[model samples]
Target: MSEEALEYYKAAEISELQDGKVHSREVDGELICLIKLDQEIVAFTDNCTHISGPLNQGEFDGCSITCPWHGARFDVRTGKVLRGPARQDLYTYTVKVEGETILVGLPPA
Candidate 1:
């Protein structure tokens, strides 16, 4: 494993997130969102790019999530901005699964 992979923090259990659902968790004081898309779990910063709205409160449509505050939308898999009042993309995190545990990679401090 690489150094980046070594920094993963346990965010959730694989069974905790159902297919086509968005789940939020706070890890080390950082709010993160986990979405199960196409049987894969993707993680992203829970804050919306527009005005720091809670992304976990947004609407998820299997492939994209829309910010509830300002109508910004992002691709769940790549964090790409799909529709925008927000120009920036969400900060995506790397996810790993070991047995039933789901780990999210955190950036170095």
Candidate 2:
């Protein structure tokens, strides 16, 4: 489905996220990670590509997050695999901020 046709779900409020910190929220029954960098908010799958580790509990360095379980690294902005044991990239979502609300976009069901 086109991005324009994807369903946008409410994930968080602006006040709930701190700069350079990761937060977890459930959207449409799927858990996702949201990180705020400066004034931009980005979204990614909560699981690590290597061993399904929890990305929300990982270390975030503003631009990238390192999986706590296996030390795998991924770019938070694009969810691209940066370091291994993980060869597969993560699934990133389109994020939109409206007023105090943060919304994550997923493909149409």
Candidate 3:
């Protein structure tokens, strides 16, 4: 995992996130979803694997998120695909929260 190149960017603020919900944020012009799992913050691409559904609008029950478009389910913590129509797992980002800011690391362009 450390072999991949990454560039960390400021993704969101703590005030913009809430528990039991997913937040879609535009970081460096790319859409990413921020979620809280077991008191830790994690991030993933906002686009769902099944037909590119907007995952931020989906139902998040604190652990798993259900896609609103095709009912695909995903574990918010590991970005694992739980149920399908979506055979591919969502892409996760390395996240580090500093004070009130959330930083997400993405591959360099």
Candidate 4:
């Protein structure tokens, strides 16, 4: 699908996130992890690619998040695989801030 076809859904309030922290939210039935990295907001699928570990529960070390279950590491910004047991990268979502709200873009249904 084209980038314009994705729908942006409100995921959280900008004020709710603090620098270098990760928060979990459910948007359109999808589990998403919202991170505030260097004042920018980033979103990723909450499940780890290897074994479905809850990424929201993982550890954020400023640049990457380490999956609690298997220690898979993924970059918070681009969701690139930084370290593995996971051969796949985490799914990333586009983020936009409108006033105090944070919106996450998802593929259209």
Candidate 5:
């Protein structure tokens, strides 16, 4: 890892999150959501665009996440707000892999 890259949290692993499961993690004080959809890895912000609800507790479809509080849906790969009440998209981080570990890059400070 480069000197500057060390400041952020890298992808830990290719985690196996079951179908309909929501995983929330905090990286550098930023809340992230890791969702496993149809055997694919998708990441997004854990905060809802509407009412700031906990998206980590939301329901997961193939590539869509439904917010628990207001039932807002978003696309994980593109962070696009699918169904609303919410018009703002969630922030996305880049992901990489190092050996058996998955690496995700955080925005530069």
Candidate 6:
């Protein structure tokens, strides 16, 4: 992760994130999704692997997220392709939380 990437999510609070919900946020001009599952934090690109759907509007069930535009499903934790229509996996980011702040790191672009 680059220094600029680290600075982007330096102030995210885990408490602000609701469980079983997907939150959309922009960092360094990139759309990212912050998902909370059973108190665990996960980050992934907001774009779907198929047709570039808005993943923020997608439905989530436990560890999987179904794309809103298409019927593709993806694992929020590993960004794995769980269902068809999207064979490729979404981009994932490293997440960490400290006290009231949540941090996510993306690879240097």
Per-residue lDDT of candidate 4, residues 1-109 (tens digit): 5678889999998888888888999999999999887768889999999999999889999789999999999998888999999999999998889999899999987
* Superposed model 6: Cα runs more than 4 Å off: 1-8
What are the runs in model 2 whose C-alpha is more than 4 Å off?
Answer: none
Name the better of 3 and 4 by lDDT.
4
lDDT, candidate 3, equals 0.86
Q: After superposition, how far is residue 27 of candidate 2 from its true place, in Å?
A: 0.9
Q: Write the per-residue lDDT of candidate 1 for residues 15-37, one digit (tens) a residue.
A: 78888888999977789999887
| Candidate 4 whole-model C-alpha lDDT, 0 to 1 | 0.91
**TM-score per candidate, in order?**
0.92, 0.95, 0.90, 0.95, 0.80, 0.87
Estimate, for each residue in 16-100, the C-alpha lDDT of model 2 and write its tens digit: 9988888988999888999899989999999998989999899988599999999999999988999999999999999898999
Q: CA lDDT of 77 in candidate 4?
A: 85
lDDT against the true structure, per candidate, is 0.88, 0.91, 0.86, 0.91, 0.75, 0.85
- In candidate 1, position 54 carries an lDDT of 89
- The per-residue C-alpha lDDT of model 5 at residue 15 equals 54
In TM-score terms, candidate 5 sits at: 0.80
lDDT of 6 by residue, 57-104 (tens): 989888999999978999899999999899999998887788878777
Clashing pairs in 2: none
TM-score of 3: 0.90
After superposing candidate 1 on the true structure, give the runs of residues whose Cα lies further than 4 Å from its correct spot: 1-6
RMSD of 6: 2.6
